[model samples]
Target: DAAHTAMWERLDLDIEAHDALLAVLGKFYGDIYLAQEGRLKGAEYLDFVLSEVHGLRIKELQDAKAAGKKIVGTFCVFVPEELTLAAGAVQVGLCAGAKAGTELAETLVPRNTCDLIKSFIGFKLARICPYTESCDLIVGETTCDGKKKAYEAFGEHVPMHVMEVPQCKAPCDRTLFRAELVRYKEALEQLTGQTITAEALAEATKVVNAKRRALQRLAALRAAEPAPISGRDALLVNQISFYDDPVRFTAKINELCDEIEARITKGQGVAPAKTPRLLLAGCPMAVPNWKLPYLIESSGAVIVGEESCIGARNTRDCTDETPGNLDAMLDALCDRYMKIDCACFTPNTERLDNIAAMARDLKADGVIHYGLLFCQPYAHEAMKVGKAMDAAGIPYLSIETDYGMEDAGQLKTRVEAFVETL
Candidate 1:
């Protein structure tokens, strides 16, 4: 702990504020995660990773830096981890899940900005996120107007690169994305001073695809009647996947899935066989953003699947490794990423179809659409999702809230009532 404190000091973190942030995080994790019963034994790995998310992981990044490896931090799924690896850099997801320096963030962005945008700015202004401090370059993307404009301010605080993500799936869009991939590859090359070769890119694609396959295995296991594992645990695994070493994280997840399969065979689960099963859809729940999931599980329901970017959208499609040359590999990367059904895209009907399909596949009794307060894209899609669910005869509830707990009791009441309907 002393070493970590000294390390944070070296990174110029706000000692008192960061300490307070960790304290709250620890207590929140204890109440939300540690209090669960009949948790899978494999979840111990999740615990260890989260416990050291800022400590050991940050130290590892620092060590990699010492060894001449650059660290690239990204906020969106559009950034290719494969390229980051091929360029000889460590890729990590930056912190943007809690309200740490809202006042400071508001001074830069608007008061009406999405909590996620504000949270990232707050983390940087508060000097509380070691991952942000550890990055050599923080890549931003133009998925929405809010984030695009916010990048103008965020870039002032950190070395930032903005990637243009097309809003529609089209032939020209594919070409645009492919060129953006080249632009990103160039950025990584400049940052790391390493040429991304075809061989290195191919190897990196395999490493990333293996991680996705492991997650896919875990998702399939949740389809078992009683849910062999809890949604909170599964969500944590997904969140940690963004921060952990890709290969080690993949192995650990596969091991966890094996245990889950064994538990399913034994008919053991975190909840009873007939517990109301629910599917969570809509806005991504980043680290420390467990409020809605906690409310759903605590309200006599078990979440079987998450149809958000942080969950299924991220792991649904892996980069095509068939492309051998660097140019073809970039095209494969573009094609795979373009399949994502993020609400930022125009006519994102794929998302509506994907949500209904995931609900049916997981045997979910209902679907709850979560939209963060002030997130226009997801908020707009929520109405469309509700109507589609209505036509399909699946029960649905929509919730919009922020990172603060002031509305927790109110949200729990609505969630409990919705669960009762099933």
Candidate 2:
């Protein structure tokens, strides 16, 4: 602990504030995660990772830096982990889930910026997130207007590289995104001083794709009748995937999925077979953003799948590793990332179809669409999603909230009412 304290101090973190953040996080995790019943034995891995989230993991990143590897931090899933690894960098998803240093964040960005953007700015200004502080380069994307502008302010604080993510899935858009991939590859190459070789990239693709397959396995298992795992636990797995070591995280999650398969075989689950199963869609739930998932599960519904970036949206696709040369590999990367159904895209009918498919495949009774307050894209898509769900003969509930717990009781009441209808 003293060593970590020293490390955090070296990272220039506000030691007092970071310690307080971890203390609160521990109690919150205990109440929400540790208190769950009938949890899979493999969840111990989750507990260990979360426990060491700010300590051992950060230490590892520092060690990698000492070993001459760059640590690349990213907020959105659009950043390619394969390229980061190929360039000999450690890629991590930064902290943006909690409401920290809001006053400071507002000073950096407008008050009306979505909680996700503000949280990252707040984390940086507050000097609380080691992941943000540890970044050698933070890769940002122009996924939404809020983030595009916020990164201008955020760049003043951290070493930033903004990638232009095309807003449409067209031929020209693909060309633009491919060029962006080349730009990012050059960024990583420059930062790490290592040219990304086709061989290295191909290997990295396997590692990243393996991780996706493991998550996909876990997601598929949730389709079982009794639901082999709680939605909160499943969501936790997804959140941890972003921060943990790719190979180690993938192995641990596969072990967890194996446990889930066994549980399903025995018809043993965290919830009753007939519990109202719901699918959560829209917006990513980053680290410690467990409030909504906790409320939904506690209100007597089992979350069968998450269609958000932190959940399915991030894990749903893997890059094509069939290319043998650098140029072709970059194209494969571009093609794979373009498949993401983020609301940032125009004519994102793929998202609507994906949500309906998840609901049907996961055998969900309803869909709970989560939109963070001031998140314009998803908030607008909420109406379209609701109509789509209605036409599909599925019940839906749209919630707009923030990281604060002030509305927990009201949200819980609403969730319970929705569950009753199913």
**Per-prediction tally of clashes:** 0, 0
Summarize candidate 2's per-residue lDDT along 1-422 as a digit string, tens digits. 89999999999999999999999999999999999999889999999999999999999999998999899999999999999999989999997999999999999889988899999999999999999888999999999999999999989989999999999999999999999999999999899889999999999999999999999999999899998899999999999999899999999999998888888888898998799999999989999999999999999899999999889999999888799899999989998999999999998998999999999999999999999999999999999999999999999999999999999999999999999999
Against the reference, the lDDT scores of all candidates come to 0.93, 0.94
TM-score of 1: 0.99
User: After best superposition, candidate 1 residue 405: deviation in angstroms?
Assistant: 0.5
- Please write out the lDDT profile of model 1 over residues 1-422, one tens digit for every residue: 89999999999999999999999999999999999999988889989988998899999999999999999999899999999999989999877888889999999999999999999999999899999999999999999888999999999999999999999999998889889999999999999999999999999999999999999999989999988888999999989989999999999999999998888888898999999999999988889889999999999999999998789999999999897798899889988999999999998998999999999999999999999999999999999999999999999999999999999999999999999889
Error of 1 at 252 (Å): 0.5
Q: Which residue runs of candidate 1 sit more than 4 Å off their true CA positions?
A: none
lDDT of 1 at 304: 95
Tell me the lDDT of model 1 at 326.
88
